[model samples]
Target: MAGYGDDAGFQQWASENGYDVPSGTVAAARQRGSSYIDAVYGERFPGEPAGGIEQDRSWPRVNATDKWGNAIAVDAVPARVIHASYHAALQELQSLGSLEPVVVAAERVKREKVGPLETEYMDGVEGQDALAASTPLLAAVEGLLEPLLTPVGGFPAMMVV
Candidate 1:
């Protein structure tokens, strides 16, 4: 199996075999093999700005490898873990009926305009122009999040928060 720290070797092998690896492929390989690099290297390489590459000096670097023998600097797994945890928490909050009120309020506020000011300003201009631009995004977010607040085998939970 190709372990970490094999990027250069992999690149060389790929080149010798007449394969053209793209930049994205290199980035993906680096991401996947980041853990392996962390295991080998002491979690960081020194900052060398001579090449004009903007390195995050504060973040520790891992010596990741690929199927070949190329090495890369990568962030440690703790960052990924923390990010995933935050997303999961947000998902759980959505599942627990936390975001429904905000959506309902937004819809209600848009619906309750009474005069030309409300219609022209809110609906005609802001709603039709500015807010309309975001309608697709809003719909997508609602579609993705609404189910989380819906009870299984029942109607969607009413707006409470």
Candidate 2:
């Protein structure tokens, strides 16, 4: 499937926002941008893929509702998603792999001390996804998407056995 928004939409957004149009094939940039979106935020989205597990993209989710508990049309991709995608696409276009998460050996430094210096690190479970330790979601993009995402570390509104 194509990215969340069309090339024309992206161009329009970039112009209106005063962002320089990145140099690249728009289709390729959009694809990478869309893939980045899925990789970074897919699991945090409130519902399952509308087209099921094999869906090419993560929008149009089933059972996704707004923050107010209003039902979001299953057939629709919200504008926030589109705008976030566009913002991400612009980042990807500017620098390939800019939005990709980096993987590193999980550091386990619980505490360390040196002469006149000491540091203690928070403990975390091992084998966490690399994304957790890598570059965080850009603030602008996260601001646009935060309301639509399920709250991390919080329970779902309903659970079915």
Candidate 3:
């Protein structure tokens, strides 16, 4: 005669009677139950975007390619890494008080995206996670430039951006 009340009391009694619970099983069960309820009741998870918009269009479009002219996916990490790395390097250079050279270098690099040298670099680093690799590259650039940007001429104290 286990009604909901009896079921609840029985569960509590079993728990108090030294029933072993597996690690994380309660949390996992709760999550699965919650997701099932949401699915059935048509509730959205917090901050989940509504459907029908292209989510991957955040980055600027680029025609990635190999030296042999083979097309690469725009979502490919090596290409994205090179693109983000160049931009980050230019930002570092600008923070070091030379915006003009960085601009020129950026323009040059942009034009050289299809050149042999960039192709070689990309090929060597191909199949690696570009975003992960770019993190250390950015950190190293910041480390080298931070000391040179210390306050001067009544400027505010240097802060790592």
Candidate 4:
């Protein structure tokens, strides 16, 4: 699938941030970055993909609004999303496969006891998949996208009727 940001945008971002990537690999890195963005934040976005279920990438949403309640145009992908994609692409380029989700083994011991010691393990904090638990998105990207994201565990612009 095509990435949200183009090679030019990626190049500009790279140059401004002091990162140098091989010219030939920029496209693939951007694609990987877009994949990472979808995998990490797809469910938390404010609205359905503007292109519908078959949409390749997650931005350009329909029925979505900004943090200030301004409508996001159906044909426009937010600049923050594009910028965040650049951040993700740069990271992926620096370390191939760095954005790939990793499924970490969950804690298995709920409780344990030794001859003279007693210990209790709390339940694994509810919700969140092990994959997301292991792979964290870049903090800089997160900051850019936060205003466009729905609050976790809360409905975004839910309808009452």
Candidate 5:
């Protein structure tokens, strides 16, 4: 398997967005995108192809959302589906509003975005939209993340050692 999308896919995304990013930068972005998707959706969505997600091979599913909380249409498939490391990035890139933020975040971490996406997250946002947007990693991943998250309120769990 070629393994989902790659630098080429990332570059295509950049070009379409009018950004002249390098292949390395694109690769980083794609890697980060893949890691992000895998972390959030792997347990629930579980991508096809085993190794990673194949945009073309990935089944089309409804109930997708964008960073702006807008409803992305699933009426028809496009001529080409942009596949990142995982389907999460693919879903974000498929969106109208998410592409810019993800690209921007990816560029910032250039050639090293993958690791950043894999780290622990969503600690104390408390379901605040403003707080989520302010966090770079969360902002880039909010579209896929927020939907999967459930809120827990109280004085926090306690354990005495």
Candidate 6:
């Protein structure tokens, strides 16, 4: 992701969390972790937290507070888009376990879990088989983001009856 963080930021986070990760791997992991977010919630543009204005994609900067009350402000686009709140964005960068299962599942088999590209396995490798266990991992990632992603999709009394 573009503005998820820099090498220094990732290192600082890793150090604070007692985890060791390479700077280059930080970018890759962010990309993959954000990919999972996309799969679950679809693409979240800049205006998502700013007010849900779909057309205002060119904001000089956007700011949104995450569940932890941390301020999330950005002026540029990461390769992957943030979910509006800077904390959620940072969460994606901070959690490698969030992406590990996804990467493993993808490597194991070619399939779409949620918002993934609908890819069919056509490699035609006679007896090739592998285990793709990602649901549990994806659930773990979702749990990490639970407080940030609440039920905001619709009203409780939308019944047409």
lDDT for each candidate structure: 0.32, 0.75, 0.30, 0.78, 0.39, 0.41
Better of 2 and 5 by lDDT: 2
> Any runs in candidate 1 off by more than 4 Å, and if so which?
1-76, 80-84, 87-91, 94-112, 115-161
Tens digits of per-residue lDDT, candidate 2, 52-101, equal: 98899998899998777878899988888888888888887767787775
**Model 5 TM-score, all chains together:** 0.34
Candidate 4 lDDT: 0.78
What alpha-carbon RMSD in Å does predicted model 3 have with respect to the real structure?
24.1
**Residue pairs with backbone overlap in model 5:** none
Off by over 4 Å in 3: 1-63, 77-95, 101-161
* Number of the top lDDT candidate: 4
Alpha-carbon runs more than 4 Å astray in model 4: 104-125, 154-161
Which 10 residues in a row give candidate 6 its minimum summed lDDT?
152-161
Q: Which residue runs does candidate 6 get wrong by more than 4 Å?
A: 1-3, 42-144, 152-161
Q: Give TM-scores for every candidate, taking all chains together and pairing residue i with residue i.
A: 0.18, 0.76, 0.19, 0.80, 0.34, 0.38
TM-score of 3: 0.19
Per-residue lDDT of 18 in model 3: 49
For model 3 the local lDDT of residue 122 reads: 34
Alpha-carbon runs more than 4 Å astray in model 5: 1-3, 46-161
- Return whichever of 3 and 5 wins on TM-score: 5
Best prediction by TM-score: 4
Considering lDDT, which of the candidate structures 1 and 6 is the better prediction for this target? Answer: 6
- Cα deviation at 154, candidate 6, in Å, is 12
- Candidates 2 and 4 compared: the better one by lDDT is 4
